[model samples]
Target: MNRPQDHLAEQDNVRRVDDVTSALEGLVTVLGQEEDLSVVLRRACLQAVQAVPDADLASITLVRDGGHYTATSTGDAANRIDQAQYDAGQGPCLEAARTGTVQRVEVSEVARRWPEFTAAAGAAAVVSYLSAPLFIDTEYQGSLNLYGAGGDGFGALDAALLELYTTAAEAALRGARRYVSARETVGRLRTALTSRAVIDQAKGMLMAMHRVSADQAFDLLVKRSQEQNVKLREVAEWFVADVLNA
Candidate 1:
């Protein structure tokens, strides 16, 4: 026969699983509504605190150009804790990002491993720490971190839940990043097209006014651009504006 405590534990596990599922669904909804990666990450951090057991604070540690920084955090304490790691050049968050694994430990246990980080975290009243690697791509490597004040620290179940959450969060972030990149590429193409049209107009005006060939007209615009220390597009735009206003 099953014990009463075992039954209660099973119930708790079911509730925790439900909470994680709801959090993941909420994240997907937020991702669709928000295009900014920072906003999405902020929401994710807040949700992580709610979804992960024993989590008091959360933050995302991002590594770029061989340097790391806290991209988004739940509160000042989390930021301070993350800064301690950055200053020390070693911490659970950094280790998770570097090793592409989950890191969970009690502050007291890891004192010797990360003295400065543990000191700062202990000062902040954060006892437990959990971090899961977030692999978006080569350009964007990071980890989602959770800080807990509870004495028992995070359990195996907590780490499993966090891994699931980070997996969903990573997919959302990758999609958002791709969307942003595509939007930027489209904006650049549009600007290029507009500049080309303006330059073509300027070339047409020069061809008509100076009776010069298309190549000669383009050469003239280049010469003016060099002389004025301005971009060819700017010179073309100015010449076209001058002729139009005349």
Candidate 2:
């Protein structure tokens, strides 16, 4: 049966679905466009601030080698909260990262649970908080934290949306990490190749000047390197530079 209220409800549902799709698409675009991990995470936090219901601020925390730091934040409010928690060594974000659990802290319970964080966050006008662990694997773990001015700002739907964001953000972070590692390897290889070419050129110069064989030229460079307590590459560079200057 057709009814005005029913049709309106269906339209609202459709709009909500469309909004979710758009947000996801936008996040994917951000991930694809940003190569710098810090920039990507900063943009991700901004997106969370805009997309999450009742979200006033957002931050991302990365835990590595038994230490934790805030990777990015929407603004000073979020940053201050994260810093307070970090200094205190206890807060919702830390809890989420350590336990891989979602923590939703209500305004009333915040002071009781985390006094230092609550005091700092309350001064910044943040009354509520939610934290979700970002887990791409066992080796890498972090947390996405959101702050709200409203006491009951986040609900079930909000948590679900944040979880979805964290998942996508985690994948993006992993890709960025792999890209960075690969680029570093390529750079190292290039540097090595360049060093080897310079060393060969230095050896050729020695061969011509001293009428020495390749092995003897290489041994001369190594001997000088050991005498000076310097790298073979550095010794070779000195020889090449000396020839250029001469």
Candidate 3:
């Protein structure tokens, strides 16, 4: 069964498909300017926040095991305390992650439902909460939350917008994630290739030092790598550096 206002969420989700084309254009242009992940997530979160009018304090959370970890925040006290709720394992963030749906809590009623979360939030001056789930296909992976100071933090329309923004974030995150992973992998491979050369030079040194054959020296290197539980390239780097620097 759908929520009371599911239709509105559906509309927002459809509208998001259109809105993100512009958002993605901005993202691609920005990517040329800077390639940092924080820069990327920050820009994406800000876009999502602005796309949704009711967001006062916007945040993104990554879901793991029906729990949430703060991905980014709008630099607000309420959103900060929301991080505490995730740490405490009790809050609207968890609820949204668990159900893969929107969750809203007014400040006045929060004390009764989430006593601990509310108390901690009171110290931070947080009074209202709304979160929309972010999904990749049928799998719910994360959420976007918006905090109001208190009272009617989000209306039906606000929830709809929240869902839209969450979807947009999901799309942008997927794109960035792929690019970052590929880039990192290429970097590691390049480094490893360099290390391989250094190791081969070190192996030659070992062969001369022990009066051993090349195959025997290589066996020694592999055995040492297993014993130390470090990468072969690390051992090679150290060996070459010692010889060169000595």
Instruction: Please give the range of 10 consecutive residues that has the lowest summed lDDT in model 3.
Output: 134-143
Candidate 1 lDDT over 1-246, as tens digits, reads 999999999999999989888888888899889998789888988888778867988999999988899999988989999998888788999999999999998876669788877666556777788999988878777999999877588999999999988898788889989999999999999999999999999999999999999999999999999999999999999999999899
TM-score of candidate 2 against the unseen true structure? 0.83
lDDT of model 1 at position 166: 89
- TM-scores vs. true structure, each candidate: 0.94, 0.83, 0.66
Predicted model with the maximum TM-score: 1
**Residue-level lDDT for 226 in candidate 2:** 98
Q: Give the lDDT ranking, best first.
A: 1, 2, 3
Clashing pairs in 2: none
Question: What tens-digit string does per-residue lDDT give for candidate 2 at 1-246?
Answer: 889999997886566545656666776787777777778777777777655757888999888888888888887778888888888788889989889888887777777988876665556677778899987555567899998887566776677777777777688778877887799999999999999999999999999999999999999999999999999999999999999998
Error of 2 at 38 (Å): 1.0
Model 1 clash pairs are none
Per-residue lDDT tens digits for candidate 3, residues 1-246, read: 888689887887667555645665676666667667667766766666566555667776777665567777888664567677876667777678768889877777667777777666557665677877765434336666777765556776667666755665677666666777799999999987788788789799999889998888888888888999998878877777888899
Better of 2 and 3 by lDDT: 2
Candidate 1 residue-wise lDDT at 6: 100
Q: Could you tell me the TM-score of candidate 3? A: 0.66
Ranking by TM-score: 1, 2, 3
